[model samples]
Target: LLETYCKASGQRINHEKSSIFFSEGCPQVRRDEVKQILNVHNESLSERYLGMPTDVGQSKMGTFKYLRDRVWEKVR
Candidate 1:
């Protein structure tokens, strides 16, 4: 389906750089199945996207730690 979409849209996707992120509490088996179906590796929920941390709902403090650190550094 993704390949078909890319071909129809004339957009090529770099699968090597692509990753699959699952919601919290997802079973490992299900995650593995999804990865196999999409041909992408399983990425940690803590991985950042566009400079902001992903899965912030899982750990608000951990996810925003980067921002807090930057703010502290600036204050110093």
Candidate 2:
């Protein structure tokens, strides 16, 4: 999902700095410009997942590991 999002958006996540709590990464597209796009979407993406529950026993650790790798890749 993250890969697809990154590819389609041309944005990369900086994992070395990104925490499980916050979404931090380079905006391939400009903030001012992207905000307009997001505004149109009305924050649906964040609203959908921001407070969703997760299962520690079932969720794969690799999901987060992959995000961390991508974050460093973009930062580099």
Candidate 3:
């Protein structure tokens, strides 16, 4: 659908700037299939979304430490 829209509209999808977020319950096999369909072989996912961390796995604080550091820098 997105590819069709991009082609029709004459716009382009910068695959480097795209990331796919799957449900927690999604299996690895399914994820691989979806990636194959999307042709998103780039393993390096963008770590931030709109200036916030995306991969906040187990440690939200650890993942968001950069934000805190930025705030401190401005205050200092």
Candidate 4:
């Protein structure tokens, strides 16, 4: 089903780079993967960016440890 969505939409789905179905994390590799996802998706990673923007960082940002929290939110 997911494969079909990607194929029909002409979107390349990278499971490894995609955010976890539930949790978040921000390891070096995962960060890079997320960056790749954003770049491919042409997402903006800015604080003002609201809702689930293409930039996962903005969407996943947490209360403390802004940077790390954002990363983990996407990875975990």
Per-residue lDDT over 17-53 for candidate 4, one digit per residue giving the tens place of the 0 to 100 score: 4443213455657656765645443322444334343
Off by over 4 Å in 1: 58-76
lDDT of 3 at 37: 88
List candidate 2 stretches off by more than 4 Å: 21-76
The model with the greatest lDDT is 1
Q: For model 2, how does the per-residue alpha-carbon lDDT over 9-67 read when each residue is reduced to its tens digit?
A: 99986644342321346363554455453333222223224433332335656536666
Q: Measured by TM-score, how close is model 3 to the native structure?
A: 0.52
lDDT of 3 by residue, 1-76 (tens): 9889998999997777666778779898998998888877554547777787767899988888888999999999
Give one digit per residue, the lDDT tens place, for model 1 in 1-76.
9989998999987778887777679999998888888888847554568888666676888878879999999999
| Residue 56's lDDT in candidate 2 | 30
In order of listing, the candidates' clash counts read 0, 3, 0, 8
Question: How accurate locally is residue 50 in candidate 2, as Cα lDDT from 0 to 100?
Answer: 47
Output the TM-score of candidate 1: 0.58
Task: Report each candidate's C-alpha RMSD, comma-separated, in the order given.
Answer: 3.8, 15.6, 3.8, 12.9
Candidate 2 clashing pairs? 13-71, 14-71, 15-71
